[model samples]
Target chain A: MTIFNRLNPGNTANAAPNPQGRQTMPDNTANQATAPESKRPQAVAQPLYAAAGTGGPMTSVISKALKITGQLESTENIQVDGQIEGDVRGLSVKVGNGARVKGTVYGDEVELAGTVDGKIEAKKVVLTGTARMQGDVIHQDIRIESGAYIDGHCKPDFGKGGKASQPSLKAVAGEKTSAA
Target chain B: MPHVTHLCIIPFGVRRGLSLESETPFMFTLARTVNGKPAFARGADQDVSHLGPGLTATGLFETDGELYVYGAISGRVDAARLIIAPGGVVDGDVVAQDVRIAGRFSGRIFAPHVTIDETGNVKGRVFHTTVTVAHGARIDGRMPWRPQSYFETLKELPETYA
Candidate 1:
């Protein structure tokens, strides 16, 4: 909690004048005068999640405490520091240290520092020193660092033939082509 | 999972296993202590999960810590404290100790404490022991008040409402 307080100094400063401003407003004109002011703090009081709605770069974070037991699809980058029990589709997927994924991960660029129990299909894949991949990886380019454990085949067949025909993967490829 | 139709009684303040703090300025605080006990035994960092706006998830999400949803979720969510931030959309059942909504929620909420902010739009039943609805919040269903024990002993959600 102290960390949050320290992180949101600007919000605390904005909130300090709120109560005093409300009390000083005349009762008759309070409705009109306080309306706009009341809305400002509500917007500012939101510490971290507020920026997600204001047209910022939307990178989805699956923190360490969460466990999602289903499919996750994202158009933006995804950083997983938690446990996921299903397929994940993202633009750039980063499996952080201590994270675990139990299903397939489809992305343009996939970075692994943790463990994946299933398959990975991407154009570019990076397996860090701490990565423990227990399933096959299909990628066009891959980098496996020392100390990385891989128990399955590393197939460089991504985006070749039917593998790229999947709807989600096609959408990702289409987005990339259109963006380029 | 029992189908029992009872009157909706709004309990203002009552004793429970987990004590609810009095009205505070901040919507939530990540206190180290939970229920008067140390939250972590290993001095681990507090786990706060955030589902950003660009994500869409379908399934059950379970966490012992706080969950902030800024994305679209369709399924069940279980957390100690859940916050649906503005622009977030959730469509499913939620089981939590404390639930705060500042976004769009369309499902059943089973919690001891619930708070709906001004921008919150709720379209389903809420089962709570205590609840707060801010001005300009839109709610389209009933909020049934149950005892704190009701949530503590809830193993299965009653499917009659769905």
Candidate 2:
């Protein structure tokens, strides 16, 4: 529970605790064209922790047809093969080849293979081939491959005075250190 | 079926990073139905977008292909075919052609065809033309019925609800 000090995914469920008590859903088969896929929830760790915002290390994919005009904030990995017009904050953000972004990107690790028209603030940054950047990049570690075009300076001050890394991530890190 | 080629283009669309238009190779595949018609008996290649369990996203997402959510997303999602795998959680409004949920969803949904699996925990409203709710699914809201035409003309979602 302490792992997600900022982003809590269980708040809604806890707020409405079992409103449908013993009320069985009707057996309606007319609308069911396909049978249920076998995707049972695994009996893993505590549901509270495992189902929290601090997901394991899985990645999220953003398809090409999708476009986001608002801010995208996540506590996990994100792969973007789409177009984004706002800020993106994630753990590890990967801008796929030919994708387009028009705002800042914040993450612990960020890899860009697309076109970015704004800034990037991260601990580690990688710009692969086919990347076209038009703004500055603030990172602690950076790698730029050949064929990547950049039109701005690369600053090595990520958490100095710029956008601070997510506090929830710090808490996660703190827990990992204490556990180790 | 003739639609198998369209189904194959879902993953190819993701790989090509093509813009939203008819120029992409994925568009020709969706020629049969484009106007929010609920997906039915689609090909086995129903998974194109995957959000793994360790990810969380907030904002609006729009797509014309298949999507699988095993993570957490809070916002608006518009897609053709969507599957919320077990352990996934979505808290927002969704306008999907075909939606299948095996996880937890708390919000308003407008779709032509909807499926709620046994492990699903849903709270709020579901506007559908055809819906199937499996046993052991927990619902704490309303499942309002709507005509297929209602979804076909749903090009512009009302900003009041979502």
Best by TM-score: 1
For candidate 2, lDDT tens digit of each residue in B42-107?
Answer: 233332567777666666665667667887888877676677878889999887777888889998
Candidate 1: C-alpha lDDT: 0.76
Clashing pairs in 2: none
Q: Report per-candidate DockQ.
A: 0.41, 0.25
Each prediction's TM-score versus the true structure: 0.74, 0.65
What is model 2's C-alpha RMSD? 14.5
Candidate 1 lDDT over residue span A70-172, tens digit each:
7898888899988898889988999999899998899999999999999899999999999999999999999999999999999988888885423574464
Deviating ranges (above 4 Å) for candidate 1: A1-45, A164-180, B1-46
Docking class of 2: acceptable
Q: Which ten-residue region of model 1 chain A has the weakest summed lDDT?
A: A6-15
What's the fnat for candidate 1, on a 0 to 1 scale? Answer: 0.76
